[model samples]
Target: MTYHRITSIDDRYFKPFHQLLQTIFPPEEVLEYELWREPIQDPAIYVYAALDGEEVVGATEYRYYKELRVAMTDFTIIGKASMGIGRFLMRNREQHLEQIMKDSGTVSLGMFAEIYDPYRAGIHSFGGVSPMNPIVRREVLSHMGYKRLELTYVHPSWDHEGAAVSELDLCFLPQNEELSELPALLIVSFLTGYYEALPNKPEAWHAMIEQLKTKETVKLAPL
Candidate 1:
């Protein structure tokens, strides 16, 4: 399999990569094609594809907030399961993000991702098909060293049209082992940068940050 950092929306693999996301993720979670095109044009956003010959087997997307010294994993999907494709893609993406931080003369804090809470939202399905079981998904992520943050996570709607997603868990993986507990300020900074970049701010945005401010640190638990 060949790994590629897809830089342009016009790339032949872009459409297929996005199609994979549509097939796996629910419509509410997947951004509109044009909306994605805008972010892909930005320097902070990174999109990658894992291909077997000409077919896209896996894909991942991320956004690096330079000022906050942190990044967010926006989307990741493996078209062919249990082939180690997801691990390979994530490994490559992390290395790339690290390089970006190094080149900018800054240290990375951590990476965060919003995952569905199986207990609250049962199994996530699209068109009657469950692409990845939520329970098993957490196990896979746990194996990769990601931990669930001990806080109520509400996924903000960037478009302002969709309702805020509360049935999700915010998982995090720090840059190094020395960074044990997640600082509340870091989470606040990351969220601030995240919401600022988007056009529409979720109504709960301010309250969420305030909620984090009340705590000294956010505890991380095994996924």
Candidate 2:
């Protein structure tokens, strides 16, 4: 019923996020838990999380695209909105991802997933029905001032021809400890855009965080 931000120190939840991904996603996609929980010795990669109470329900684990100068939402937003908790959790995740942006000076964040937000409203409205449960990715690119190019490649799957699989299989790795009420599925929906319909792809889709540079273009247009 509450939102919690998963920090590096919060070992209790971080492990689960890793374990969960390992079980569901292909080993190739799952990164080491320690590498993600610890600070980026690389100066670019940063790890973050969102929790329900003390339970880590959602997470962002990826290397900041430094050379390319963009941060990609790697994977790990997992929570349930059945009780309306996912939305609140998203606010925290966005804020965290934004705070990390100060260093790179780039808004172009990239991510991979399989589906879209079934509950998303605003500039990110998607109309197509998702065969998968629907996962959404976050790319911090638009803050750089490009919405169209900002969303050029927002679907998951480096290999579109690959098969689909349950993200849960990735989440249940032995190292992951199950949190009480955290809905990892719904939380994943907002970040990675993966659904159940496709079961062998291992991974599915991706997205970027979109924003508009609204300036005072009109002075007397308020009539």
Candidate 3:
């Protein structure tokens, strides 16, 4: 198996990438081709694909927020059950993130993952079929030294009244040469603060962040 960073969403890769995603996630969860294609065009988004020969097996998508010094990782999907594909993709993605940060003059890069809480019932739940369970994904992330910091919710659509809030677990992995400069707690605080300032319904984000701040962060095991 080989891994590659996809700079462009060409048909050569997207066709298989879409297929792999469809195979893993349900129809409701899958983003339309145009929707997925548009974001990848942004220079800030990093897309990586794992290939077994010419066939795509797994992929990961992450967006770097320069102001926040955070790499917001969206999804890490492994097409089929395998021992190390997920880890390989994650490690490679991290390396790519480091390179991007170095180029962008970003130090103390923080890796963040917004995990949809599978246990949460109702419209807020992130229910979908996948080759690996969400709990397993959390285990892998934990093994990689990411800490669960807070629980929050995001409106998946623009509709405020009817839209269902998606329950999210905000996880962070601090990668910095000066560990004292950017602690895990501080990183989480910065992210929540950033969200709280969003123009759309800033009050709601502030409320969520405030609630999250009151909750104790989950202790992480040593890597």
Q: List RMSD in Å for every model shown.
A: 2.4, 15.0, 5.3
1-223 per-residue lDDT for model 3 (tens digits): 7776666557588878878777665454456676655656767667778888898888888777777777777678877665477778877877877787788898745677766556762232122434356666667776766766534555332222323345556667768422323343555556554443223444555566566556554343232
Cα-based lDDT at residue 50, candidate 1:
92
* CA displacement after TM-score superposition, residue 216 of candidate 3 (Å): 14
Please provide, for model 2 over 1-223, each residue's C-alpha lDDT reduced to its tens digit, 9 standing for 90 to 100.
3443345545565676666555444443444565454443334445555556666555555544334433344454444434443344445545655676666566532332222223441232122212113333222221222122112223323233443322221211111222222232323333333323223343233222121122211111000
Displacement of the residue 213 alpha carbon in candidate 2, Å: 32
Put the candidates in TM-score order, highest first.
1, 3, 2
Off by over 4 Å in 2: 1-10, 23-28, 32-43, 83-89, 103-223
Q: For each candidate, what is the lDDT?
A: 0.77, 0.37, 0.62
TM-score of 3: 0.70
Question: What clash count does candidate 1 reach?
Answer: 0
50-84 per-residue lDDT for model 1 (tens digits): 99989998888898777887789987777876678
Q: Whose TM-score is greatest here?
A: 1
lDDT for 112 in candidate 2 is 24
Badly placed stretches (over 4 Å) of model 1 are: 126-131, 158-162
